[model samples]
Target: MAWQLEGTYFENCNCNMICPCSTSGLTEPATRDRCNVMLAFHVDRGDVNGVDVSGLNVAVVADTPALMSDGGWRMGLLMDSAASQEQADALGAVFGGKLGGPMEGLGPLVGEMLGMESRAITYANDGREHSVQIDDAINVKVEDFVSPLDATGAGVKVSGVGFPADTLAAGHATASTVNIFGLSWDNTGKNSFSAPFAWSA
Candidate 1:
């Protein structure tokens, strides 16, 4: 079966100012010599197999030991509670790397699946900020970056990170919470960003 998901995604990690995991370039060690990241997505327009999966949300949270390049990543995925069994299965197949797509490109890096949950998920991008909540699993808020030289803040873009997209706006987390995968962190003021995305399998 063929599937495609066009959406927007946001992510935050406990890396220095920027997370090398997103770019697939992590020659140096991160702040903690590891990466703990939470990523969420909103499918404004999508379809899986023959099922319509629009207006749904999904997420993948991970804890990677050593540099992102070193792999050995453990992760958990959250699907939209409202999705049907068919749609849910499709999302899982895609995100789990069982199907081909951008995720499949990273298939070699993932080492474990801690768990999966389908619960109320929310992803919103207001004029000033972006926020995502997956039931009680996590809550994240990303704020845009501003320049000291310029008074009016501009969305910052960083190209060639680990994300599938060509570029992503740089952000800093205002609020971050996690309670799953035996991984826990409150990474406020950490590396954060958002960008549009498209994936197919």
Candidate 2:
């Protein structure tokens, strides 16, 4: 069977405003810290082979011991509570490295999987204004970029990376001091990344 999924997602990284991993070199915090990020996907309309997966929400929390390219990751997953057992299974398979998708490449780097939780995703998209929250691990609010800003006083914004830039999004994040399986994280700083993505099953 063959299936395709198209949706919108946002990621909040521990790096500066514009994470460099998307294009430039990997992130290296002074403490040699890792990158902690949360990705939330909103499926406008999608299907997994014969399974109807429209309107379902998926959230992935990941921690890379070092640069993402180095792999050795730890992850947790959250799904909408409204999904049925089958739906949950499908989502788990897709994200847990059970099914082949964009996530599969990260499988070898994964350790200490924290299983899955039931949660809801909320978003408010009003023109260039965007806000999203995932139960708790994520909270973002940002303004749309009409053009470029000037000088250092413009605040620190990292560019030269690739992500969904059309969602007109932004936000800061706060998470618990999380250490599950092989991952650990702290809730400090904000995050902002949005882009369109596709997946298969």
Candidate 3:
């Protein structure tokens, strides 16, 4: 079975501005002793093994050790409530790294699977700003950094990292809070990033 996804992605974590994990390829220690993060994706167009998944949203929440590359992450997956059972199953297989896709690269890092749930998700992207709300479990909003030197207010970007995107718009979270799966955190004013992503296998 072949699958592909093209989407806008954003994340917020309990790390200071310009997260060391992102810059150091997940090898550096987090600003805090642990890294609690929420990553959301808005699928503009995609399909999973012949299942249409366009316009849907998915999110990943995780609690990891300070050094992410050291593995042992407790993670959960949230699927759009509107998805049919077939769609949800397909999404789980892809995002859970059960399929041989980009997400497979993250498989080794997860030591605990927090299980999956269906939740109402709201994903929004307005220029340099991105936000997501997952039922009552999570809420996060971020704004990208704009360099004064550049006349265009484009976000400052970093490239060639081990993240989902080839380049990510560096930024900080304006507001972030999470309380789910026994993992709770308020990472407001911490690190955030956004980028367009395309993954297939």
Candidate 4:
């Protein structure tokens, strides 16, 4: 009944094929020399301080200065409108760093919480391609990549990084949509990935 979660997310950022932020973080300089990103998550199983939060989705829009290790990120949030008020409130607390857990470390990095909105979040996947929609403001998709060794076309993966996901499957953005926080871009052809994650505290 303590706070715990198991989930997956796909992130798209304005960077080269592979994002350095995921591997080197801020210490090794950004892929494009900075970090601006949007990510969406589907919590298959979760709870916040005993509040059940299964089968819900959340999305975040953010901008960062320099390395993420140095802190100074601004963020906006979107929680699934289909969720009950309690579910939405619990998700807001975690996403906003109020409840803490895997997101606790993010607290120091975030300089501002743009806001949280309850919206219709459509998160889905069709085998290889992943898609997410937040109301009419954001929509994006990423397709898993084929690893060099995995001839079966399994997704490229990496581990031991600072991202919420411990092992993430790599991919590229197929579409990137934005209309929140003055952030705008079509990140298709940019860096992207997804991973199953677990966090407890």
lDDT of 4 by residue, 88-116 (tens): 99888887777667677788888888888
Judged by whole-model lDDT over C-alpha atoms, candidate 2 comes out at 0.61
In model 4, what are the clashing residue pairs, if there are any?
A: none
RMSD, every candidate, angstroms: 1.8, 4.9, 1.0, 1.8
| Stretches of candidate 4 exceeding 4 Å from the true structure | 147-149
> Which model, 2 or 4, shows the larger lDDT?
4
User: Model 1: runs farther than 4 Å from truth?
Assistant: 24-28
Model 3's C-alpha root-mean-square deviation from the true structure amounts to 1.0
Residue 20 lDDT in model 3?
88
lDDT score for candidate 3 against the true structure: 0.91
Best by TM-score: 3
Q: Write one digit per residue (lDDT tens) for candidate 3, span 47-149.
A: 9999999999999999999999999999999999989999999899999998888779889999999989999999999869999999889999999999889
Question: Alpha-carbon error at 194 in model 2, in Å?
Answer: 0.2
The model with the greatest lDDT is: 3
Instruction: Mark the regions of model 2 whose C-alpha exceeds 4 Å error after superposition.
Output: 24-32, 136-138, 142-189
Candidate 1, residue 105: lDDT: 73
Give lDDT: candidate 1, residue 18.
68
TM-scores, each model vs. reference = 0.92, 0.73, 0.97, 0.92
What is the lDDT of every predicted structure here? 0.82, 0.61, 0.91, 0.81
lDDT of 2 by residue, 1-201 (tens): 766677777666666554555444344431237777766677767776577778777878877764666766667898877778887777777767677776676677776576788766675555444556665555555443443463433333335443333222343444323343355565445455565567775
lDDT of the structure predicted as candidate 1 = 0.82
How high is the lDDT of residue 120 in model 4? 93
